[model samples]
Target chain A: MKSKPTACFLLTVVLSCVLVAEGNRDVNQEDRTIEWWTLSTGAGEHDPRTDLNRLIAGEFHEQHPHVNIEITPLHVEDFKKRIQIVVQADSPPDLFQSWGGYVMFEFARQNKLRDITYFVNSTLSKLISRESLAVYSYAGKFYGAPYDMGAVVVWYNRKIFEHAGVPVPQTWQDLLYAVRRIKDAGYVPIAMGGKDRWPAHFWWVYLAMRLGGKEAFDTAYGGTGSFTDPAFIQAGRLFKDLVATGPFQEGFENATYDQQAGLMGDGIAAMELMGQWAPSVAKNNATTGKGLPHLDVFPFPSVEGGKGDINDVMGGGNGYIVGKNAPDETLEFLEYFLSEGVQRRLIEDQGIIPVNKAAARGQTGPIATITGLITKATYYQLYYDQYFPFSVGEALNDASLLLLTGEYTPEETAAAINAAWREFK
Target chain B: MENIKTLYSVKKLGLILLLIGPAFALFTTFVVMPVFQGAYYSLFDWKGIGPLNDFVGVKNFVRLFGHEPFRTAIVNNLKVVLFSLLFQLPTAFFFALLIGRQKFPGAIVFRSFYFFPYVLTEIIAGVIWRFIYNPQFGFLTQLSGLIGPEKTEIAMLGNPETAFNAIFVVIFWKYIGFHMILYIAGLQGVPKDLEDAAVIDGASPLEVIWHVIIPSIRNTIMISVFLSVIGSFNVFDIVWAMGQGGPDHSTETLVTYLYNFGYKRFAFGYGSAVAIVIFFLCLVFNVLYQKYIVGDSRS
Candidate 1:
């Protein structure tokens, strides 16, 4: 009887200890975990994004002490598809990157996006611009935080222009002159990638901005009026003329983005009329040639008879968004991310454009150049396709590809756009 | 006595149900249901999202007919099917017979070499051919340099003229081995005495092959041809990897066009309509093939 009592007493003590240990583990599990999914490109056997993610995670963890952020950086091409698949299935990352306009609009319409209006109104309004917030708004509600913004700007290879003895084109006429001059000098004036359908939208957006002005673009894309305006027709003609000059590399319609980037990087092309994010892509690809230092930007040269001005910016926002179904701790983490310190770190270290205007101007070095551009912008043309309805946007993207490939004449392209708009509406 | 008979019948019925129950359920859930859903979705216009699905009847199919490129994709698919029937299946069968009858040193090694490409994933095969077809840095281009610039400019898969043939070449090289193995298995079933008797009758090698060998493996050839035809029509990876039907979309096949319309363009309704057409075509061809070509053959 004495031995049985002693054994029971020991067993009770062991059980109590086990319960205590389990309780501690539960608390630690809640405290130490964070989850994030990002669309990180260029990840191969040893992706740079992996190291970057680890470093950011390490630093964040060090500051938080009791937190660990789980990061999954997916391949670039697969990013949108994977995210859509996951998020639509009611399982979403704590934080993800989504572009402004229709891309966010679709997610918002599905009620898949978190309304960050309360967050913005309460604490974020003072830091982030209302303009930036307005771009992320859909049906009068903010769906995401602004992370980066860029206008579609022409980036030129200085060496190529200089070798061709063609001056940098300041006006619309000068651009045509440069194109002809560069072509005569035996260097391709422009290296446009038609293989990547998304990139083909450049000519469309540029022409839209040039002909219709920012407001006309906004009205057309917002599904207000007919897209078959004479201005759009004129823009199409200009695009055809540009194509007629044969400024692009031989068989450029078949060339991939990387091939075009390679040509521009090697000084084989005088100019690349693309978005501001192109500088980073160009810089990364630079090897035997001096990269960004030898590169400079300008807004698309003003169409002489067009209403658009030189300062009118054309670009879209690429930024991070929090999930509506994310855990409470994730919201807290996002709050921390929006803090000035983190925003500053993002701009300074990562070269990522911060959504906060304060963060933008305060940033230094290469990021400052982007900041300068943002500060100087008098008007911004949001990426038109993203602002348009899904079907309309898709049709426009198709029309752009068709236009470049000579599958449709300029008039037909304009007609197609209007037809698509009518059908979609 | 009636009870006993009924009990026996019930037991037999139960056994019958038990044998087919799982298989029927599996087919119903996986294949039949999805196909039904696909057919249903084809009638409606939806982005595969939101609460909205607008029923537009056969308008999507009408629109497809109106589109020229889609018609081209269907033609391309037919071309691929024809290429497989005319070239890959026959070539593979002939080689399989030759290898099966011969007794060479390291014959197994030679067979393994032939089957090596068949083991590779489609993506890997595509990448390998893509490298070979590279205009600037490809091995073929380098070899062509030894010949001349005119040959180098052939742009095998890049040019519209040669793209389909180039793709067919890759398909043949990769899948011929699979059919070869099939033929080899069938060749083993051919009675050696029949061939020996033919030889004893003063029949030539070609005659023996024609009268005995060919007839013996008729079933295998039919099956292989059917598989090759289906596979060729369904191919998307090679064309996608090579140039995504570029240089003016000349190389597009049905599957690739369907993928482009559905995924890239987000035209799910039109994409589904395309898929339904492909499905019906495959069904008709399969039925016709089995009835007229395959079932009639006796070996």
Candidate 2:
């Protein structure tokens, strides 16, 4: 009977520890824990990226014995849902994954992010590129930095291109001709994941970027111009012309991003407009698990009679942003995470394009080519869906889907986008 | 000693209140309060955070009604409800009539077999159906390819015209067994004497069924219809896993439309407005259903 009370006391102590696991730093002031959340892209629970991140965190902990890192790796959709709640509550993790545009700006505007401008200017300036860092900047203050970066380009199957007997396209007309030829050769000309919406939206983004360039985007985004501008309409018209050829695989409207990658890997589709992550997804989805027999990328072709520069690029990348309640050690961890040593490993094993300038030298093959394309670009436009406010961006996606389906004319599509833009604050 | 009966009744009432207190509190806190809170939040243009200062009354509703996708969602939901009543449940009733007789061989076996679809989770069913509907390598596509002349390709969920109906078929399959089982249970209560009386009175199987078994199982049918109507309004998982209400929102239902355009877009105010509309829809439905259709049975 005496032992019963003692047992209850011990149980209470254990329960308290369990409850305070997430509340560790709150109770003990001396213990600084950096809660880092990153999105795990693959289906597997044990993502290599997360494993590498844990290793890096271990190293960091060794260096700073006073600090600890609690890593929470979530899937893409789960991360999006969780981040919104946490940031809105103003009790976000110390460091979390960020795509670094409208959403980041929204968070920064709400004073949820730590103003790490000084850290960037003093330490990270020498490590990462200006373009990658600029995305995290809201009203002249840096909040984050990217570890991996790449531009959106047409990833094509070289063997399929060889079979179709088409040279690399340099102009809009040339791309159209190549697409027709490829389709006639009994292969899907352009593999589009219409169900996902973003994959189909990229065509419109590239076309708009090619036609209107920075001037059109800036004028429209700044509210000096409107989405119903002739440039946007023209972009829609060109995309419609591409749609006329029925270049996508049968039932493209329901095809998810994974299916698009699968087609390319299975050697059924000629090309796809995708980011650097496309190849990895294709490899996993491939029948043989080796992916495409011969894979290559070329810059999106220039549109004739357009104001845009031919070398202009449109893309975005993965990065991290700090919460307002982040510890000082969070900056140090960011620095180490984006350092040359770690980044080189990322490039070598994961086939990631590093944002670190020193680590860029290690990139070879298609990744190296992408780095070159991005570097020589006179203009780099972020993906419109990410760059614009949440609702307006989603409107663009919805409009783009309608455009590709040929349900709406170019004028109608542009009008739809403008309507949504008008409603946005 | 002066009021013993009253004192005992008061004690019993006190005991009842004490027993019901915790459950009542929980129900009000979680369910009732959220409904009222959602109504209040529906008025403001709140983004799930920051100040609730943006007071935009009735504007969210106006926009929601005018929205094209929301209209599609409403129509799709109505189709689901209509199909459930006119077709799915009727078919289930027919099957129940066939198997409800204990004398029918393999009656339990058929019931178990029919109920198998309901055993699978909504998401698992969706994923399995997605594989069967794949345009390139799907089972249906391959089977059609063997029969058709032009190397037949059928993208059931891929086509906007067919996607909703295609998913509806899967949903119909999933729920048919449930209603059939409900009817079967109701049939057990239907005394054999009345059925025998109808047969002796020169009534055919159809007429006898209409007069006798149908009247006896009226309560079960009402409950089944009510469940089906509510389920149609709230259908999300299968549709979501299948297409996420895509192919231009062709397969969109009310709840899916809310998730896609509301929460996913971070328009919490709009989402709240959607919730309000759905609440009123369900509430009105429940009230009308209880009062008009099955009120007598309750009384």
Candidate 3:
């Protein structure tokens, strides 16, 4: 009887051991995969992130067989707000789209963004350009990957120009002449949207660049150059002069980006000083057999003796970044994205420019021309508000709009900018 | 006797605790905690997510005094308060008196129509107003065209001279409905015997409303005025959506300016300072209102 009880106990112990082993095996299988969250604006019925998630998931699973990417597309504005909240909550995205500026730099400083120099040196060096990589650099550390270059260029309505008997402007003087002629023909010269202060920033920055070359811009942004400097004041004056031309739509200050683009699409304006992404708008509006106005891109023209040339760039690159908290498997997904084939897919299929050097540049439109300009250029200037300290950038946007709308004189506008900078510093 | 007294006191204590516990916990989490965090953030020169920030004491406030847009934002907030006082409250009171007691044709329908706008979210109302004020396609411009082509380009929300008023019109359209509803409640609460007695004395409708209805609804009037003041001071979403407070910061409110400072420009410290100023201003207004206006109403 004692032996029977002992035998039963032994049997139970062996079975319990096997069950524990089986449970551990299941956990081990689950441990190899990773979860990735991509911040995207889930617009329309079909989310673009869903397609990207599927592509990355397919490749990642095939290669590692142990990784999974979980993509959640938040609204565009919500994405930025969520990052701050989620990071504070101790759970952030694995990878996301990041503008290589103060926002990303702040993340990098906070150690929320991984210093991927170690990984890039070993695996991603040959895949990206040195110039492209430089964009993601801050304080001597490379933080993220450059995904797309948002190079600002002028988008002109060719049919409007042809109708007005004015050719495409090749120089600053030529641009003014074209504007005058277009005005005489009773057509708005430019479709600028001042409703969003950032859009109005383009004119100020362009004029600032024209008046004060790169060195002057560097000096001004560095807190040494005065906004009250003759050059800055002159830029403000130039802005006022442009506004006086009555070249913008009647209610341009109320016009949204869509409205501004719509004006060009409807032949209400002759040209738009915008980024290369404008061709996408053209393509979108070209559905009718009548088609959109013939579209062309150009660089901002030179000032009389200023060193800024027709080829000097006024743009920056947008890039994908891996989170510092991302698991190692997430890095595998980035490697796939940095590949030439995927880069080409982004360009040819999605209209986004790829940062990879090996990506074939076969896609047409403003991306090709912008890439050409980038590759062939000798010098470049970062956009103004991008480089300005936060408070001053707001002041710049406000001052420019206010100046154009007759709220501030040229001198007062310059003083306001300087005062804001003083406060910021 | 001692045991009975102890039991009574204990029961009272427990009841008090039960009554206050939920609200205290909620207030700590939502209000007190955020205020403390904002105060702490104001001390640091943090650009959102960064490693180390320089702690600058009171510099953010000093900076605010010198910044022009901040000044403009304060001025603009004052303008909004003035506008609400001049237009929204009086109009709402007038309509409430005119319509509250009547049984005219479609009176209920008209009351519902007046109340409809208050039901809309601010951004939706802003969009509707945007279309109504649209430069090229809006009915306003179409009507303006009846005058002349030059007048047709009035640029209602885009022109600096009119942008603030355009935003005010939208705010008025939306919130006047709320005030009207409040006034309806107030008017209903007014004693019908007094107004009937005034009419028997040969008082006109306007005279009866001015003397009897006005005094009776004094408490509601006080509440409405105070709410309008706070609402106007904190105006943000409508102004933000409508031309983004632009055509020269003509419509920029303290809240929108704070938002732009913090989110758009990444000056969290400066934004927090602006927020604190707005907070103090609200506190002052509330205190003054309670001390003077509420006391007057009671009297």
Candidate 4:
């Protein structure tokens, strides 16, 4: 009996010591650490973006000596998959990259994100554009902030256009004419990456935007209409028409995005409908290492008699969302990171279109062209995959690709999308 | 004496249990538990995240059977199975017989060369093959160019009809060595005396192989068939790494279908349903095989 009492007392003492050690660890953790998960901007050994990130981080550390910031950089696809697992495990990094739209909305809906609406409306509101900020917003509440926003545009090889004797297309008919001329000139008109289905979907989505503009999308997405709307079907039909012209390179259906970039960079293909990252990717993938001597941007041409203005754009942006349990300093760091000076540095060096209104001043060349389109746009729509639920987004990509292959008619494609929406909505 | 023998047997049983306990525990925790959990999850309309409150019952299964892509996936898996039995196994067996026990100069080099592909990871093999299949700038194009300039560009993977066949060729190439090695090991067990007796009886080489060698190695053949069939059903990494079961989902296997529909779309419930279907398919095949082949042979 005495031994039992003595053992109980010793057990309590040991347990209390263990508890105290754990308590100390918890306090130590709270005092001085933040984890940031970001996508690596470059694939090679000498990446200036990584250097810039470190420079900014060093500056931040100097400002806040007590807090230590740890950045874990991952490749884009790896980051996406890892982040999903991390978020599901309920131990997301303090700050992490997000491509704002339905995916972010899903995270927000699940209460996995920290609501930064207060910070957005108070201090950072004046710094970034509302339109750019809207990408990261969900249900009228801000969950993240965009640092880089860009529009999809036609990236053309100037030499190829001159060789074919075709001017830059300003209308759908003109674009079709250019395609015919380019093909007749013994070159593939467009370098498309159909194996990675998102590139192909861009064609259909852009057509939908050109045909119907914001109202058609709004009506369909707002539950007042259906995805099988005439405008959407017409978009599919137009995409099929483009596919029928044999615009894409040989084996394009199996070619990856890198391969498509290679084709454009090598001047084997005339044009590619891609984002701002096209030039850099093409340059990296080119046989010459220097890519095209003359590369230029043109907007996706307007459809004849369409409701959409030619200036309306289809695009999205990269941003960082705060995790649910992130420290207050995470938001502070984001604000510092997105300041005008930092944004300008990123723009000048990284070739990204600035989300900061003040930093938008010195933009030139292709970046300037995209910035101008964003500013003059009548309506800015996010990519369909980003804007819609995951299932519906996947269905859209599948349906669009099928339509491109002539495997599914426009009507059938529309029905497939509508059916997926019904099931998953 | 009887009491001493009983005690000794008890000790033997204790030793056996002790040896197996840790592995059994691990397998139960990791494999068996997850399999059961997956089955349970198949009953709900749950995303991978959050609580499992939405009980969907058999709706996921019903939907899977009705899905066109799933049907395509099933057919693709069957094609793989058929091809493996018809082409892959026979090729491996033929090679095994050719040099399995033969001691010639550079025989070891030949064996290693044949086994080289099996040593390469599935993803690496897929990537290498993708480059080889590239229409514009690949070895295939160069080879075709030798034949004629007009034949230089051929996109076998781009065509839906040929995509699955191309993947099948890679599968056959990568796994043939493994099956060949299995057959070689089985051949080593065949008694030389039995072959000599068949030869002495004026039997031809083919007859000797059919009557004596094949009967002796039937167990190994059965096991290799079992492994090949299971492997065909679970072929995901190669297909995924190559085309992501694309060019219009033509290369989709059952596992790839499960991944694309379930994990990619966050439809965990539906994915679990797919898992259950795959499990049952493998289970039914294994049970029937064991009963008809292994059990019958043993008896």
Please say which candidate is ahead in lDDT: 1 or 3: 3
Question: Which digits, one per residue and each the tens of the lDDT, describe model 3 over residues B225-258?
Answer: 9999999889988888787767776667889888
TM-score of candidate 4 relative to the true fold: 0.93
| TM, chain A, every candidate | 0.84, 0.91, 0.85, 0.90
Candidate DockQ values, in order, are 0.21, 0.51, 0.51, 0.50
The order by descending lDDT is: 4, 2, 3, 1
Judge candidate 2 at residue A67 and give its lDDT: 89
Predicted chain B of candidate 1, TM-score versus the true chain B: 0.92
Task: Tell me model 4's lDDT, rounded to 2 decimals.
Answer: 0.89
How much does candidate 1 score in TM-score?
0.84
DockQ of 2: 0.51
Over B221-283, each residue of candidate 1 has an lDDT whose tens digit, in order, gives 888888887887788887787667654567788888888666666677778888888888889
Q: Which residue pairs collide, candidate 2?
A: none
Deviating ranges (above 4 Å) for candidate 1? A1-36, A42-79, A82-95, A110-112, A180-188, A222-224, A266-270, A279-293, A325-335, A362-369, B1-20, B97-100, B105-110, B139-144, B149-162, B199-205
Comparing 2 and 3 by lDDT, which wins? 2
Tens digit per residue, CA lDDT, model 1, A259-361: 6676677767778877656656665655564555677666678887788776777777677776777655565566666666767765554556677666665
Q: Which model, 2 or 3, shows the larger DockQ?
A: 3
Model 1 residue B214 distance off true place after TM-score fit, in angstroms = 1.9
Prediction 1 global C-alpha lDDT: 0.75
Q: Candidate 2's error at A284, in angstroms?
A: 1.6
